[model samples]
Target: MAYELYYWDGIQGRGEFVRLALEEAGAEYIDITRESGRGRGTGAMLAIMQSDGEALPPFAPPFLKDGDLIISHVANILLYLGPKLGLVPDDEALRYVVNGLQLTITDFVAEVHDTHHPIATSLYYEDQKEEAKARSAAFIKERIPKFLGYFEKVLNQNPEGSDYIVGNALTYVDLSLFQIVEGLVYAFPKAMSNYRGSYPLLAALRDRVERRPNITHYLRSDRRLAFNTEGIFRHYPELDIGVS
Candidate 1:
């Protein structure tokens, strides 16, 4: 059976990470929120979220419905899908290691979101512009390098001495990192002007992930959405510290 993914209709948001994994593995799935039917749109996602069943309800979007299980959270959803889609290592220890990498990316994504919505998610970006500028300055100057550099260290220290994050092969973590790099580049182009020189391994991995057969097709197809101000990564020049 095909997987049913629940997420917002517009921005890529956290949902794009899961979408990347499923696409790379060529898994059959339905992006239910984007579908154009009565039972297959955002209402479908709301119904699931508002259900009063005994099962635990997800607090947000980017949840997956597979068989009888409803998995939510980007990392949690990927944790379950990785094994099924052959995007993780067979060794149990290494799988957990990759999971750690994915969780770190989750933290990095949260920080990126805070760059634009520093004060509060409920408030408009305009309302928080001054605070966002201050927060983003610190984020671009510190957090970006800290997070991206950590991933660089991971790629450089891979025991197998491969380009991939975990083993010599691609894992879901690699896909997540690729998505993060893409988002950072889009949201902070001025700040990322030297990304290749600063984080060569991570940069190379992003390029390689882009060229993967399935990913290449997906990027060229309409299924892929462009990064926008509405998403976690928003481009606001004044917020960035620029290339230092």
Candidate 2:
């Protein structure tokens, strides 16, 4: 059966990572929220925040429904799907390394999210705009370089060369990295522009992922949504230094 993906319908957010892997692997799946009349939209997503379902239901969206299993957490979902989707290696050690990298990406993602919502996720960006401004400044100056620097180090240290993160093959980790760079660039254009040149392997990897046949098609198709403030990576000019 085709996997059923449940996420807020609009803006890629965390869902796009899963979507990208699925698209790249040519896997069959249904984006539930975008199925015309079925599934929830932003309203439903907000309702879920207060509903009892929040406790037991998939914690945060980009959840996957396959058969009887309902899985949440983007990294966990990727871990489960990686091997199933042929996006991970077979060796146990390699798998562990890939997962480790994926978890690091998760940390990086959380940091990125915190840049815009440093004070509180419950508070509006406007209410926390001052904190965000400070946090974003640190992120652009310190955090971005640190995270990107770590990834660059990984690439340089990889025994398999810089073409891929794990071994010589492409894994879900690589895909997630591509998404990170894309999201960062989208959310912090000025910061990214200034520092992206330092990570050539990452830049090349991002370009290659986008050029994948399925990803290319998806980018041109209606399934892809533009980034907006409603999502995790919001672009508030006041918070961003270079976006005028």
Candidate 3:
């Protein structure tokens, strides 16, 4: 059976990370909300969430439905799918290490989301513009360097090589890091202009992931959603601070 991925329509959001893995692995999956049918579309996804009969209800979109199992959260979904998709190594110890890296990436993603919605997700960007600017300035100055630098260090210290984040092989974590780089560039082009120089190893890894045959095709195809202001990584002119 095809894996069912449930995420909001029109934005890449958190779902893109899973989508990238499925795409790269050539795995069969249905993007539920993006399609329309009797048991498809955003309504179907919401119905599952709203259903009282559901024993394992997901708190939000971007959950994965594989057979009778429902996996929620990007890290959790990726962890479950990694071995099956051949995106994660078989070494028991290494799997935990990869899961940790993914959880860290999840932390970084939450921080990225907070940059534009510092005050509240309920408030509009215009309402929180000033706060967002302050938050983004701090993020660009410290958090970006802190997070990206750590990943760079990971790549630098990798026992296998710097080509991939965790092991010598490409994992879901690499796919996710690619999305982070892409989203950051889209949401803060000016701020990330120096990313290549500052995070050279990460930059190289991003480039390598981009050049993969499946990834290259997926990126060019319509399945990959573009980063927009409506999504997690919103670009406000005032929120982007240039490198000092």
Candidate 4:
């Protein structure tokens, strides 16, 4: 059965990570939120999330429904999809490691969202302009290095002697990390200007993931959504430093 991915209609946001895995696996799936006409739209997604029929209702977007199984959370969704897509290893221990990495990416994504909506998501970015600037400055200067540095260390310490995040082969975590780096670079080009040489392993991984036939095609295709202010990786000039 084809997977049903429920996420926001327009933006890539957190859903792009799942899309990358699906595309790479050549899996059959429908982006339910983006599909318009005849009961297929954002309303369909809301229906699923709001359904009381299910014992467990998803609290947010980007949930995946496969057959009777519904998985929520980016990390949880990937954890379920990983082995099915061959984006993770068969080894149980390794899967746990990948889960940890994916959760880290989730944390990083939250911080990225906070950079734009530093004070509150209920308020507009313009409302917290000054706070966002301060938060983003610290994010660009301190948090970026801390998070990126941690990933760099992981790549450097990989016993497989390969650049892949979990195993010698590419896993879903690697794909998710690629999306994180891609969004961050797009959202903060100036801060990430030195990302390549500084974090060579992660940079190389991003390059490799981008060159993958399916991912490359997906990125260039209309199916792929562009990054925008409405999404997690908003490119506000003032939110960034150095290069304007």
When 1 and 2 are scored with lDDT, the better candidate is 1
Clashes in predicted model 4: 0
lDDT of 1 at 33: 86
Query: Total clashing residue pairs per candidate?
Result: 0, 0, 0, 0
Candidate 2 local lDDT, 201-233, one digit each (tens) = 788888887887888998898988988888867
- Model 3 C-alpha RMSD to native: 0.7
TM-score against truth, every candidate: 0.98, 0.90, 0.98, 0.97
Model 3, 149-234: lDDT tens digits are 99999999999999998889999999999999999998898999999999999999999999999999999999988889888888
What lDDT does each candidate get?
0.91, 0.81, 0.93, 0.90
Q: Per-residue lDDT for 29-73 in model 4, tens only?
A: 999878888777999989888888979889998899999888999
Candidate closest to the true structure, highest TM-score? 3
Candidate 3 Cα errors over 4 Å, as ranges: none
Against the true structure, candidate 2 has what lDDT?
Answer: 0.81
Off by over 4 Å in 2: 38-56, 242-244
Inter-residue clash pairs, candidate 3: none
| Candidate with maximal lDDT | 3
